[model samples]
Target: MVNIPRLPTATQAPQRPKRTDKQRKAEQAAAPVSQPTVVAKAVAETIKDPAFIEEVQARVQYDSPQGKNKQALSAYLDVLHQAKREEYSHLLGVDFYV
Candidate 1:
């Protein structure tokens, strides 16, 4: 009778190195962060412009529903306008509430 060599089992498979907490943390820290959204940039630009508010005021009737929506948007733009350029500058990079 002929005898054949046995194949390697799972127990004999090569093992990979386990990552340390420091290495894991380093990898996480090295990851790139997300940038600001398009809406935020547009809001920032609108905040810098005075004519935008005037244009909204000119086109919308204060009593109508559509006008109310415009008013709300205009008010929010006003808030962004009144906010300190230095203090809220970081918020300009965000899409919504900062």
Candidate 2:
């Protein structure tokens, strides 16, 4: 038999296990409720303001990702976390530390 070149074994970074919907909801529920911060309020207002949104849309030459803005999604999340979400962000995943 002719000699065949050996190939290196493929390797991949381990993926974090996916949490079930129940688990996600439980974690979200476990997250403590806190008062919205002034910065969070400002961000929500700026993103929700019709005039500001319109101005930005007008300025954008390319198409926007959202038809419904749905900007409220992120706005609400930031408000819920008191704008501290980034503090717990890591390479693998989030820790709900906030």
Candidate 3:
């Protein structure tokens, strides 16, 4: 008889137990509401200022990242716009995310 190496079967592999819907719901219910940090709030306030926006617009150089500059600029503009939306942010509900 020839000697054969033993191999583990699928059932022998470790498995992570899936959470039940009730467990998931319980976790969601236990989660705390999210809020912005002081630094983030300060940044939002600074960006909302017309003078700061103008300064940032003037300082943004397309040469910094070539073709990707537009996306970066749009993101920067979005951050500035966030200050205006801060009060209504919670209205986004479940879709809210970082």
| Residue 45 shift from truth in candidate 3, angstroms | 1.3
Against the hidden reference, what TM-scores do the models get?
0.29, 0.29, 0.42
lDDT score, candidate 3: 0.79
Candidate 2 lDDT over residue span 1-98, tens digit each: 35457965666899999999999999999999999999999999899889998999888786444645667676666688864555556544776643
Per-residue alpha-carbon lDDT of model 1 for 1-98, expressed as tens digits? 34456954445568899999999999999999988899999999998899988898799865544767888987887788665644555666643343
Candidate numbers, best TM-score first, in rank order = 3, 2, 1
User: Among all windows of ten consecutive residues in candidate 2, which has the lowest summed lDDT?
Assistant: 83-92
Clash counts for all predictions: 0, 0, 0
Question: Lowest summed-lDDT stretch of 10 residues in model 1?
Answer: 89-98
Q: How do the residues 1-98 of candidate 3 rate in per-residue lDDT, one tens digit apiece?
A: 45457954445568999999999999999999899999999999998899989998998876555567877887998898786667567665433345
User: Which candidate gets the maximum TM-score versus the true structure?
Assistant: 3
Better of 1 and 2 by lDDT: 2
- CA lDDT, every model vs. true structure: 0.76, 0.77, 0.79
Q: Sorted on lDDT, highest at the top, how do the candidates line up? A: 3, 2, 1
Task: Give the per-residue Cα lDDT of candidate 3 at 70.
Answer: 76
Error (Å) of candidate 2 at residue 74 is 37
